[model samples]
Target: MNKVTKQNALRAHSWAGVFLSVLLFLVCLSGTIAVFHFEFERWEQPHIQEMESVTPATIEKAMDTFLTQNPQESHHLFVVFPTSDIPRLVVENDHSAYFADQEGNLIEKESVSFTEMLVDLHLYLNLPHSWGMILVSALGAILCTLIITGIVAHKRISRDAFKFRRGGNGQQSQIDLHNRFGLWASPFHMVIAITGVYFGLAMVVMAVVAQVNYGGDRQAVMDQIFTPDPILAPQVGKPEIGKAFAQMQTLAPEKTPLFLTVHEVGAPEQFIEIYAKAPNRMIYAESYRFDTQGNYVGVAGYEFGEWGKQLAWSVYRLHFGDFAGMTSKWLYFVLGIMMTMLCVSGMEIWLSKKGHPVLATRLWYSVVWGSVSALALTAITDMFYSGSLTVVFWCLMVVNTALTVAMKGLSKSVWLMISGISVLGLLVFYLIVHTTASVTIASLQLNIPMAVYVCWSLYRANTLLKRERMAPSAKAQSGSPAQQTPA
Candidate 1:
């Protein structure tokens, strides 16, 4: 009965992996890339003057300048302060965002962020907010299911801890690689899955709870989980940004203000909020509240909040492995690759079991490799075209699929080879685009990853081609008796 249960668990795990293959891959890959979100921002807008700290007067000046341009529309205001990765100040409103120099001079308008768009894919699969998040959370649930069942099925996990085979046939090689990564990094994967599920389902859960207890007062429910968004009203006096900073120094001197947000400009109910990050806190940043006159309100309690609240708020950092900075992000990036390959290999095993249907295999390769090719190519084109990258990416994927369909009787490996070639081409294109541009730390941050991935893509493509070339020879050497089949 125990053995049977284990077999059932294995079956369930494999089936779940098959069911969630593509989405899981998309989420994991985007998340891996998004580890460099701040760096991407720097790369996106390098023209802005960067500094360690911008004065409160400078922030106020930038805010005033922007608001003056649009007097009729009082959009919610956001100020993104300089960080280690993004060493510049940015102000965002409803319509668009622009960089502010150290002396509060409004710099050029910021461009659309492809890196952030990629992050959105991980967050919501680039779907509409509510539905996308719910669906992504569902993927997280499925991941947890896979993890539990996988452990059950691999009951001899400890015994097989050191078991890894390098050169073998496809399934055996894949199994070995999968088990090694899965078992070794199981804890980290579990944390990622749980936190991912938390973020994915958090809003839904809040809405449901709001419906049940608060009579569908969504705002009330939100107030319980988060500090409420400030109310807007007509006002006379301006907010003192410098005063607020002075108070925050006394409140959280150990922390650095990451961003400052003014909820409603020129309104009686207007408020200023600063997101400050302390040295070793897991929560992204704690909100420090202030009135328009810069009089300090209390902290949002995230930094020294209740344990449950603190844990709840730490989900984003835990999910993306951002807490430990670059080192942890690198670890996550590698694990993310492993996780994506795990998805592909898991599907590969399932398809091999199902007689390796040519149709399914081809479509799988098209979606996985083709999407990667699209992302790279989109970055390349973004330098030249002012079109929407989201649209551009999906269009590229559709084109890739069409190419797959058009090429009759070709192996799926061709798509991978093409993807590798496309990636290499993109690297060249990126170099060409930035050749004459001023080099910054952000450029290194972006280009180094591209170089690494080009090599990764090349390795994958070569491996696929080598396997394709050896397939017929492998079949011929299998020692099957062609003549004895007559008997």
Candidate 2:
């Protein structure tokens, strides 16, 4: 590439990273944690009974108990049976989830808001529905642009593959770290970006498809690719969930049942969809539909269907890294952190090339470190308190950002230390709790990783604090400010 072309590519890369870096950081970090969303849910309420297996009859009894207690007719009820990952029978309605043992005895009603909060943050940054998805998808596209631009602009990227420098030049060290992490994890990052766009922009795609192919009948388009609603019939009898489960086992014994959803309860159109996880399949699950009489209707085409149907069903597993279980989760978590680092260091590169305004640097610190602190605050609060957890999280983030900005002279290292301590504090809190089977395992899962992270944070914080210059200066250059400024 020519000199001018290389410089323009660099500017484009910088522009992409600087504009959406913070939002990308937020999404990536939350998504990393959301990889263990089910475990987090288990941690939130661990005392709920967990068992390896439950009889079909036991499931029916639990559903009956729930219906008898509620009295009011519910539109639907979902029963999520025990699995290796989440070893609990969870019965839920629109409002709340109820836990039950293998013997059909009710344990308690609890909410897993911490996991929900992380999901919301990752999925939409908690924006309103339509705007949130659209914007996040747009950011995904920008990330793709950055990926291409970054590769194009890095003239000696291959030569500097394993370079590491951390001496007098802060920008060089940041760039090295950024490049090392980014280059190693580039494929994973690309996978995440493409899959993320598919999920985030699905509704928009669906709308366009509806207009072009389905005469603007969105439901018709959806039904073609997805499961259609069951035909309405006269209300005859209550669904025998146990019978359905028995028949399902006979139908697909190779698959492990995950969830059973009863639709339109007490209505003529009522039916059941039993979700079963197929072994060694990329598709998340295959839905086994059943009629009101507990007779098996058929399996949803996701398991044995055309290419389009199978591909559509695979989206959830592919995007969330749930395809291969624990190994996939760990891979997703590590790559996710690398993506967050890329966002941060990409912005730092721009700052080093141009100028790092004190306000911009402080706000950057507030965004990065303050978010770390808020996550711990909300997780600890969710464990202890019973109010609205999302509100608590948003408020804590605002307060942390305010404090970071107000303390103008405080170094970013101080914020890092504070967040590190907060994380350790959260670990201590988790330690003091009454640990059950699920809690014990969940605690171990998070605490071990968190310990390593806290150590890294402490080391980074100390190193930064020891620096001669608190804020880095722009490098001496031959170019003018106009060339230095990103497009």
Candidate 3:
């Protein structure tokens, strides 16, 4: 392209990047940590021993035992049977629940874990359901814009695509890292962006469609997609969960029951929906329903329905990287980190152009390093504490944010040095503490990769700090007012 065209493209890219970079970085960083939420949940309740399999009889006994303890709440009891990932029977009364061993003894009360809180924060910023998701979806759209403009800005796309210069001028170094990560992670970024948007926009889309096509009754749209027509109301009577469990086993021998949902418990229209894992499918788990009397109803439609319903049902599994197991999770995690880097680097690039303010650099340091530090602290906290993970997480977040705001405009080198040292120290401490926990082999397997990534990030940050300290004039030459101005 000619000089004028190139300049125009750069101008557009710069404007887009400035507008959306911070939001994009937050979304990407949160998403990366959220990948291991289930693992974190397991780590939080280390006392809950793993079991090879939890039988229907075992679950029934647990349910009966739980009912005996809370007789009045038995009608509302719901049990989530343990899976390979989490190996304890989890039983709940309306507002509270506890994990139990295979023999039905209570282990731990229902308390949110730090990692799960991070996932919630990442997806919805811990906002109330209504507004939080709307904000998240808006961020997703901004991410799309960043991706589009980033591609446009790189003029010699193919030649510099895979290049990563180890030692170069500062701008060249930034550009190389940017191009390398952005190109290698392009497909992964696209998948995450689309899926993220889908999640954020799903409610909005449903609302619009409901308003336009279903006269604003969103439940009608949802029912058409998710629920099956009610079979003729059965005679009102006491329901037997045991019989329903037995009948489900027979109807779906190949599938395993995930959970059972009892609707309108005491009424004649009350029915049980048993969500079961598809025996040999990568899609979402299927549902099999039965009446209160335990008579088989019919299969839910999404598992055997039209294209749109199937596609919609599959989004959670697809977006969350839970569909294909370990390989998919790792791929998602790595890509998530790259996306996070894209966000961080995008912000840095903008700041670099307009003069890297000390405050801006410090904020970046706190966000990038503080995130890693928070995660490490959270994992360590889970290994010991029994209170509320959510409380601990918010406390850590508040402390980190406060520290960042306070430290802003200080020496960038000092902030980087301190953050780097803290991250490295935390990683070592976590590894030592974590080794003493009664972690299952499965949990360890998942955590090992995460540990490696954390160490590498720490090392990288430390190395960057060391180099920055050795070159005082480099900061001055970069034209940042904070570096050039006299005290």
Candidate 4:
């Protein structure tokens, strides 16, 4: 591109990043944490019975017992089988859920408010699903635009790949970090952007395609894209859950059953669908269908299916880095953190370029760090309060931001100190509430890392405080404007 073209691309990139900064940051932060949604869910109910496996008969008994207890909840039913990730059998309907013990007895009602809130923030921003999803997907498209323009704008991106200039006006360091992270993570960014858009926009895209090729028959489009629903005659009390489970074992022995859904529950036409995860494959799952009588129907074709269908099915795992067990999850978590930092540094670059206006800088800092503190505070709130946690989180976020701004922007160290304390408070409160029952692998998985972060944050904040305390004295001893540090 020409110099003028490059300059225009730079402007476009900057404007796009500025527009999406806060929402994008929240999305990235929540998504990074949401990689362990299953773990968090398990941690929330540590006292529940967790078994490695449950028989088909046991699952059937549990379902039957659930139906007998709550006859009104017959719209639809589901059984989420235990997996290596979450070894707890979950049976739920539209409104309520319960855990099944080894003996096929319903134990406690499932509750994972904090995990649900975290995942919802990432998925729908706590808005109604339909509109929230579309907005988030649109942001994904804009991220693609920013990615392309960013690459075009940096004419010497390759040459400056490893360059790092510190101890300057701070702009250079921010710019360098932004460029470095963007460059290093470009491939991952592009993959995430494309997959992210697919979730919400897929329906719209399918609709348009149906309009053009199938005379706007949306069902035809769905049938073409996905496996068609099985037609069945009405006449049923309950689906043959055990029979379908056995059929699944015989049919796809290689794939592991993740969950089973009973469609049109208690109706004559009700059928069972089991989603089984294929080993060493990325498609979300290969589904097997059966009629209410336990008669085999057909497969969903995500595995060994059309390339397009397989690609579409694989989006969730690919985007969230859910493959390869904990290794991939950790990788995604670290890269997600880097992506979140990229958003922050991009805004910092804009602020630096604008001469670091005090109000703007303070507001941005309040938003960035205040968000971290808010999440910690909200998690603490969840331990004692059982009300609307989504409301609590956002309210805390606003309160944190307003408090910071009212104080005319506390120093970075102060924010860090607050965040560290909030996190420590959350952990301490959790320990107090659960006491000895809180000690579990799932709980420790999250708590240990949180405890480590508290230590790191406090240590870093103290070091920064010391540096800030000494800076004025050092400048006074020199007694020169040139000796003063750049903002």
Ranking by TM-score: 4, 2, 1, 3
Name the regions of candidate 1 deviating beyond 4 angstroms.
Answer: 211-218, 228-235, 408-413, 473-487
Q: Each model's TM-score, in the order given?
A: 0.91, 0.91, 0.85, 0.95
How many angstroms is residue 465 displaced in model 1 relative to the true structure, after the best TM-score fit? 2.3
TM-score of 1: 0.91
Per-residue lDDT tens digits for candidate 1, residues 389-466, read 778887887887787778754455666666777777876776676664436666767767677777776787778778
What 10-residue stretch in candidate 1 is worst by lDDT? 227-236
Q: How far out, in Å, is residue 20 in model 4?
A: 1.9
Which candidate model has the greater lDDT, 1 or 2?
2
Worst 10 residues of 3 by lDDT: 409-418
* lDDT by candidate, in order shown: 0.78, 0.82, 0.70, 0.87
Any residue pairs clashing in model 2, and if so which? none
How many collisions per candidate? 0, 0, 0, 1
Tell me the TM-score of model 2. 0.91
Tell how far residue 224 is off in model 4, in angstroms.
1.5
Clashing pairs in 4: 235-268
Stretches > 4 Å off in candidate 2: 230-235, 435-439, 468-487
